[model samples]
Target: MLLRIDHVGIACENLEEKIAFYRAAFGVTVVSQEVNEEQGVKEAMLHVADGEGGGSYIQLLEPTGPDTPVGKFLAKRGEGLHHVAYGVTDVTKAMAAMGGAGVRLVDEHPRHGAMGTSIAFLHPKDVGGVLTELVESPAPRPEQTKLKNG
Candidate 1:
């Protein structure tokens, strides 16, 4: 089951530059950062709202190579909004449900994502021309539960 909007992916030519812009203009802080070799991207997650787990984020993505998907995207579309990711309880089930419903998928199986989450992507053509991602993060800690309620 999908829980909520997880994050918005923004393709950028440089991660540090984009990160600096967000920090200077919006005071957004990078909560986590990592490079996903499989995804061929260097990503930085900036948490918004209350800084609680499962909250929305801005995921800055820098292409690792010109041949990668994000790289090709940048070459064709330039740097801009790339995808919108939704938080799900079970990526496998969610992906299956979408497939059963005839929704086209970019990733047919859940794969490793930034921040140790399970993730899959739905093809843009099937999702109203927006590349959509399904993310399933580990259960939040007790403190996060309190933050969510508070």
Candidate 2:
């Protein structure tokens, strides 16, 4: 089951510049940042609000190379909204259900994503012309849970 709008992804040529822009423009700060080699991008997740057990993020993606997916997207569409990610209870189950319903999948199997989440992408054509990602975040560690609860 889909739980929430995890994040909205924006494609850009320069990650640092965009991050700075967001920080200056909206006063949001980066919560996490990493390079997912498999995804061929360097990405950062910026917090949208404060004081939360859970909250949505704005994911800024910068392609590592010209041949990467985000790179191609930039070449074609320029820097802008790329995809919307939905947090799911189980990405494997979600993929199965979407596939059973005849939705085209970009990933046949879940792959590692930023912050250790299991993720899979659904085809844009099958999802109302918007690229969709299903994300199953790793269970929070006990210390993290306590921090959130306290």
Candidate 3:
């Protein structure tokens, strides 16, 4: 089902400040950044390690509006750890298996996620009160392939 630990999400009031903090404190670099309108959040994926191994990321999330999920979370719990994401080869198949096993899900179907990934969320209550995300990463682009091969 799960391939590897993809990224750990952290909710923030200010994405730029958080990104700067991570860069200055941990020296991690931002690999990608995007706003997902459907999710109502702007997010950045920061590379957690360096080298050819291409380590995992720390995802910083900022809500787009007061009514958004991350915004409500900030109002209730303040900025902190949000969710843990695990990589999967196929999120659809993973969701089906998990559903068959009676794991409650927040998303019944996979949706578009950052960096063109397919993603789904599992209910926090069913997963020890921590939000869990299933992510199927997008294929490497031609530029990425060239970089890796060169």
| lDDT at position 140, candidate 2 | 68
- What's the lDDT for candidate 3? 0.86
Instruction: Give one digit per residue, the lDDT tens place, for model 3 in 1-150.
Output: 667687899999999999999999999988889998999999999876433322368999999998999999999999999999988888999998888888888997899987888999999988889899998877863345666789
Error of 2 at 44 (Å): 0.4
Candidate 1 Cα outliers beyond 4 Å, as residue runs? 50-53, 141-150
Would you give me the overall lDDT of model 2?
A: 0.88
Q: Write the per-residue lDDT of candidate 2 for residues 1-150, one digit (tens) a residue.
A: 768788899999999999999999999978889998988999999877432334568999999999999999999999999999988888999999999999999998899987778999999999899999998878863345666789
Alpha-carbon lDDT, every model: 0.87, 0.88, 0.86
TM per model?
A: 0.90, 0.91, 0.90
Better of 2 and 3 by lDDT: 2
Residue range with the least summed lDDT across 10 consecutive positions in model 1 = 47-56
Clashes of each: 0, 0, 0
* Residue 86 displacement (Å), model 2: 0.4
Ranking by lDDT: 2, 1, 3
